[model samples]
Target: MGRKLLSLLLFASLATATPAAAAPTAAPQPPTELVTGLSLPWATSFLPDGQSALMTERNSFRVSRVTLDGTRTTVGTVPNSVTTNGEGGLMGIAVSPTWNGTSDQAVYLFHTSTDGGQTQNRVVRMDFDGTTLSNRTVIVSGIRSNTFHNGGQLKFGPDGFLYAGTGDAQDTSTSQNDSSLNGKILRFTTSGQPAPGNPFGTLVYSKGHRNPQGLAWDSAGRMWSAELGDTQFDELNLIVSGHNYGWPICQGSCSTPGMDNPKRTWTTAEASPSSLAIVDDTAYVAALRGQRLWRVELNGENAGATQAYFTNTFGRLRSIVQVPGASAIWISTSNTNGDKLLRSVIQ
Candidate 1:
């Protein structure tokens, strides 16, 4: 072959060999089942040594220690102030950020409760002795609630601030009202006080959301939220301080006049995103109604190259947590009526 022809052929081959920046085509190895027999598992927290996890059951209001071998023992039941209903009950839980045999170490929980005939969401801190719970205290409360759209996701940000995502309590207008804690991501100290120098001088960190179910922070300390939209847009947002994410006004994109658009949006069928975990530069979204795991590459909050996996492997994916020092993702299956947990090892 002529030298010029050979060079052209080599370039063409290289182009064909490179993968496109869309859905990953390489069939990831089938995920191995980790544990089964869980009743609508909601959230998971890794132990300090990463061998065990604490998982919450939604309707049962039960929190249990799940070992790597799939053995489960009930730690304790979350204090219930109201009856468990659709999408209400024990929701999110996180271990104390400063938990190193400290006296103040506790497991924090976020759930919906009924008070005076009005449903409300609250955060409570419960002391854990590795076997049971003692000394439960309400950390923060007064979040509007309803049968659905009770945004219940909590995590400690790298800045040591306790962040909670709240829903609009089925009232679309509340998302835009600054005075209402509903439909916003709240930032507060461990003592449940609003962080000093908040943008609004209150617990409201950012406003204008529908039902935000996922909260995650990247290594750069940037927060991202996954929200369920009303029959239109399911959004993934790069949460910024004091920025408004238009809910009823704007569904998707940046078309709405004073609101920030999502980094990416999907149809409700494609992603009813429940929870998210950012590993390296990739954001993995756990889908509930969509029943899939979405992988979105992150370029400084702006998303690129999206992919989906686990189409029908698990009925409903509730949460995804990265296993530290391992190339695996621990996924909670909401086969509540069925009960199962899965661990996905990315190949």
Candidate 2:
């Protein structure tokens, strides 16, 4: 899509978004270890049956099928994945919401790889048949990647489209560039084309992000994101299509017009939030530096005060997703030293 045309379409979509409605909130119980002896597990997406979930290991590039009862099986390693030696590697997996054992068995993944030996990030599709993965096909590719800030988080929104958060690839310029895919939240079709009705004619749903890693939707279908900041602050944002989140221009909150401020902000020491999950209208953020789970209640398009859970008890919390059929959540450790998956009940 041409930059000028894309810009016009993006702004057009912006004016069409409606305000979000709030949902209920709850407190989560202390987490208990479910699966141990894992590597750097980065993301988790449960199968439609709710009996098991598919998880990704960053440095190892291994995909594992983990049962609700803690049984873990190595499904397959993603092909051509490479670690950036900092943060880039195999990351983000989303099981198709309509996946069935027989036919509609699509699953998606986001990872760092080399295309013609040039480092980039990609979104790929594979088929899972309750046992193994096959038919690997690159759905979306050519997003710039670096050692760190290669934003890698994928989730299927309630609208039935795949959403991916891409980092600025350490190039601050890319976040503000409408033509670049980096530093943006992108919407895509099952076949990897830009999703229809996207604000931009391209895949970009929103731009000007630093390193957005967490993506989730509330009961009202409002999109929210958790982003890692450069030095001072981290952010939780209520995502609106075609919005521009201040990045290099503004870290947390600024008075700048045309740049949206975060709904909530935290000091880097308190929250290097890597992943987010929404349950009962409450936002649960997995903190990497603070080593805890931070909860923020959703109040319509705004957020409430923050609370911390299991502080310093878990080492470098990474992924957190609500259990498919229960009022519980599954979390993963990212320390890479015999990490584990945990489950927590919400009350």
Return the top candidate by lDDT.
2
C-alpha TM-scores of all predictions: 0.89, 0.92
Please give the lDDT score at residue 75 for candidate 2.
90
| Model 2, runs deviating above 4 Å | 1-25
Which whole-number lDDT from 0 to 100 does residue 144 have in model 1?
Answer: 80
Q: Model 2, residue 200: what's the lDDT?
A: 83
Report the C-alpha lDDT of model 1 over 1-347, residue by residue, as the tens digit. 99999999999988887765455533234677777767888888876667777888888888888887778888888875453467777888888766643565578888876545666799888888777866778888889878888888988888888889998888998999999999999999888999986789999999999988899988788999999888988999999989999987888886777799999999999889999988876788989889888998888868998998988777788988877677678888786687677777765
Clashing residue pairs, backbone N/CA/C < 3 A, model 1? 40-336
RMSD of model 2 against the true structure: 13.0
State in Å the error of residue 22, model 1: 15
